[model samples]
Target: MSLQFIKRIFTSGVFLISANVMLSVTSAHAAVNIQQWQTSVGSEVYFVENHDLPILDISVNFPAGSARDTADKSGLASITRYLMTLGAAGMTDEVIANKFADIGAVLGGSFDTDRAALSLRTLSSERERLQALGLFANILQKPDFPESVLAREKARIISGLEESSTQPESISNKAFMSALYGKHPYSLDESGEIDTVAKIKKEDLQAFYQQFYSAKGAVIAIIGDLTREQAQQVAELVSVGLPTTPAPAPIASVPAKNQAKEQRIAHPASQSHILLGHTGIKRNDPDLFPLYVGNYILGGGGFVSRLTEEVREKRGLVYSVYSYFMPMAEAGPFQIGLQTKKDQAEAALALVHETLEKFLNNGVTEAELKAAKSNIIGGFPMRIDSNKKILDYLNVIGFYKLPLNYLDEYNKKVENVTAAQIKDAFNRRLKHDHFVTVIVGDPKAE
Candidate 1:
């Protein structure tokens, strides 16, 4: 079937499900009227007023991720964020949880290398909205980092760390990142070593929060049943209590040049977990579109992808093999990961390396490019079929300073990516001899 025919069927009501999906796509891409502004306290606010739902979703992001942790205090940032919701002002953790539940509101948050975020979803009614916002602001600005709670969380994290050390997947991932980033802060796992986590005192969490959780570092994305005026007010409430200071400068990019190295750990696992790659592109890299489309065709598109076809289907060496580039503030790792029987690990690795080299030299075919773009474009609506998903995109765009029309332009950008562009971008960014490899399990000796 032609693209136009699919579009017509989806855009029209011949099928209710397809029509509804298309309507969601239209609303997300075309009606995503993001209004942006800066609060007096220096927080950047991105707002979208959607009255179709009687719910409100607000996410407040800060530049306080694990990357900001000092080497000695590696997990402080994550612990600080986790503790923020536990105890604030005079309220206990139970009190905070009960307060949100009493009013039918939900509290959520995340921690990663480059960012820390806290989110809220609540009914848009005045009583619930005001109460929830009040609770959120308190958690953001008035976190107590209670000493008893600190000890308990530290014990919990250390226990988890001790368990993770024996897991093959976790061991390989940690070692792979260390090899890929060397001394870079990005190498540090969000969950720091047991020794470091055990040493983190309550004072450390308080100090870290005070230093990095400033108004200027805030990226507030608010969406739902609220007027622009109300959104402005909500943004102010979220950050007004924060200290007014500019955020720290962006982290430096990972070095593009590095010596290739291999790390093999002796583990008694039945299968070997292998991971390989090097520093990839940053969020604002010029070749973002080409690389995005190219990676999909190479290994990210599942069964149709080249890596899957060669490593899994043709040889039956493994159940799955995949590759992806994690676009971040600095150059993130371009990882190709897989698992295979311990005896077949060497063969699997050789095939993977050959597949990558061949694709880099020859690039994808026209048919592959066309199918990749079609699949990516067709799947766009599923990405933003809900308020939470749209909120996530909005939050990222605001946090990373991405263009407001990123969602609308995404499909067009994929459609325009050419095979030549993919080859050129891939060749320039990924060097065959400069990647780091980590394998955990018994394999043939070199």
Candidate 2:
């Protein structure tokens, strides 16, 4: 916000210094007052001090991800992620929950192919925030993995997995990932298979925790009413307490596409579950901005998107049809998927393919480019509307080592992106024929 905007807010009788307004301003400046440090015991830390609100958000990630899980014990990382805060270092699950409740804090986490993260959001009222953060730090740095809690969380997790197995979407996703990744560890679903989850033991969790929770692989991001010293303390608070050393990074390669082929799986469902994509752009690809804007014109945006207008509005091929590419460490998959009646599956699929093929050839129209630009540039402010959202952007920026003026230059970049650029970039990189298409449903049998 400019001084004039603040003046206008003041003139309108809004608090001359509302905490939310202050946070928005600080994030807009995007200089992040980011402080850096290392803990005495060897933890790397990143900090941003904002005295705007009485709220603190802290998140830490380590390499304790599925890539590190043993092949036979694929789900162990996921189970460990859930069980950490369930009980840790002399604290029972009930006691842990009660302690957090007493202080009005929440703790949670998830493990994915690349990393595992634990996070907490709490009121920055001195003692409550400290108490909550301390407990979270202990769990990450020294989880007890108590036997009973592990047993219970595993059982609950297994139950959910079994239920998921019956869903067509889950089946299609499993097949899609397995087919796309081939023999790579990335193919293993983070939730793991049923037998794998069953084999997870308390000791496994402890060993995995010990190896991957080091500060060397950790990234901590925080936004709140904390001083630079306080934020560093909080970052060091989480990981320096852990055994220090970096886990060996994984050796993985992007899978190649076996495009122009169709594989069908038999399933008992009303509508076929459809998934399609080849490898997509990597997280740090230079083509990021151009391709992103191009994709919005293609599918990522709803209703106004070419995919929706052609597949849904013109032909009524399916209730909803969409496409997206998840940029990851390597080229991720670009997928276009939807479902119609069993008999209409082929017809719907045909229309989707035709629309995409046309898009690949002609690219987006001039009107489409104008609208996409307008919608994208118009709503860019919401990208950093909240501290939490800004933290997400900062995480990406920090992890990807993007330019400090990324947000400031956002609009200029969008404005400079022409229809010709979108077309050229999409055509150069997007090989639709390279993607594998997987359909799971008894369309023929039905």
Number of the top TM-score candidate: 1
Q: Residue by residue across 313-353, what tens digits does model 1's lDDT show? A: 98999867999999888998899999999889999999999
lDDT of 1 at 83: 96
- Screening candidate 1 with a backbone cut-off below 3 angstroms (N, C-alpha, C), the clashing residue pairs are none
Ten consecutive residues with minimal summed lDDT in candidate 2? Answer: 17-26
Tens digits of lDDT, candidate 2, 1-446: 12343233223443232333222212335534555444555444545666777889887776667767766998888877778877776888888899889988988665677767788889987668767877887787667888887788878888999999989889888888777777777678888888998988878887787677776667676877887646645665575577666645754777566555567888887788788876677777777777888888788898988878887788886767878878776676677778766777888888877877887788778888888889999998888777777667656555444655677778888878887787787777777777677888856644
How much is 13 displaced in model 2, in angstroms?
A: 42
Error of 2 at 174 (Å): 0.9
Clashing pairs in 2: 280-332
RMSD of each: 10.4, 8.6
TM-score of 2: 0.88
For candidate 1, which ten residues in a row score worst on lDDT? 17-26
lDDT of each: 0.86, 0.73
